[model samples]
Target chain A: MGQRTMSDQELVQLYLTGQEKALAVLIARHQDKLFSAIYVLVRNRAVAEDILQDAYFKIVSTLKGGRYNEEGKFIQWAMRIARNLVIDHFRRGNKFPTVTDSEGNDIFTYINIPEENQEDRLVANERDSKLRQLIEQLPAEQREVLVLRHYADLSFKEIADLTQVSINTALGRMRYALNNLRKLIEKHNIAL
Target chain B: MTKKITQERIIQFVYGELPFEETAALFDELDNDTEGLDYLESVAGIGTLLGSLMVSPSKAIRDNVLAFSAHFTEE
Candidate 1:
């Protein structure tokens, strides 16, 4: 409470010790990355923002009540909270989070492609469309792994830890994802 | 007679999941093999472009988050 510069772990300690502002700092530190994670799943900016706020509310109340473990892995714990909220939102909306659209279309279908005649630009656009379509075609399990691993920048170990899958299992899903994408590309003759 | 790399390994490599040593070997292979290099570059480019397509949340959304969090401090 006295302007003490604290590490995230120390901040968590302050929150547990009844200093509320410390909790605010912790939330601010994580909000952007956490929101980005939620947004990628929900793909709805408003919904992601809402979930982020709700996550903080839950984190604060839960921590102040001594319900949090001080395992020094507080970011991951908060991430778990944000992940649950995203899942709940999906369930409540009845839309599979990775599916983008209920009709099996890639959500990026609405993405506007800027016009350009350069060979590089044309190829890049074609590739972008193919990639989105391929990702949409992936099984939900594989898609989740790819998104969390690449888009969210989670390590394989972190992904396994978060998803509760073994490391090899996570890696396997990623493997299937790539194979499936290649197959889809070949099958569709998408000129990437 | 070229060995086939699984689509999974290709994705892993594109996403930077391959081990450093494996990556160096893959890089060498890609440099010497036109087909392999083309395929990898295409897929990696697609991955990059798809991710860049999303618009960052607007300022209104950011303000909403700030407002909501402000409730705790306003007390």
Candidate 2:
């Protein structure tokens, strides 16, 4: 089987057994979602990047020290570390520079639709940008639950554990998030 | 008592969070309830749309992490 197709657990095992390239494969597989999860919380690209690097460094150290026991839960384990780092960043009152585009507008204010995909790109991009903006408008609690569930690929139960809330509360937040998004879409007549 | 399917339950159902029996029951109800089915479609659509918002760390960050991990193998 190609290294790309290996499961996260399998890759970790390979890395542990001295196949160093396995580590790179594992990181590549999860880098987007993991980084996006941190970015959503931090809302600053540079700070999120720093937190992501720190999280990866810690992940390597833990794996090397044989301290990682989660096996198949590598992403979640790493995400928890990243999440804690974000919390620490907030706790320290460290100010994150606002991310802006070339026009000096907040990056989150408008989506930069990628031009890679040809057909259906325009409609898809607009819909995506609208949905992103609506999500950004959601209450922080609801948005966190939504981001963790959708972006982080975490279950509501895991989200509850990470966010220090009950399972029901997590479910409730997600429900509210969707409901709010639906309302926003309807109110704005978003065609998606 | 048959659990009345609320929006919350619909959310759970869409995400496959309902228990097997509850899921079976919901599916049965969904076969008859056009509104429920539409709601499910909308929620699922939003979930898919959220996929476009996924962001990756810059290549520089990836390289930094890889470089950092490289040291562990060297040691």
Query: Could you say which candidate leads in lDDT?
Result: 2
True contacts kept of each: 0.14, 0.70
Interface RMSD of 1: 4.7
Clashing residue pairs in candidate 2 (N, C-alpha, C atoms within 3 angstroms): none
Q: In candidate 1, which residue ranges exceed 4 Å CA deviation?
A: A1-33, A70-75, A96-134, A182-192, B1-13, B28-36, B60-75
lDDT (tens digit, per residue) of candidate 2 on A34-145: 8877776776767888999999998888888888788447777888998889889989996545555564544652334465564456555455545656777899899888
True lDDT of residue B67, candidate 1? 55
> What does candidate 1's lDDT look like per residue over B1-75, in tens digits?
053453445566877778888888777767777777666776685566445544344456445544544454423
Clash-forming residue pairs, model 1: none
Measured with C-alpha atoms, the lDDT of residue A94 in candidate 1 is: 54
TM-score of chain A of 1: 0.65
Each model's lDDT: 0.65, 0.77
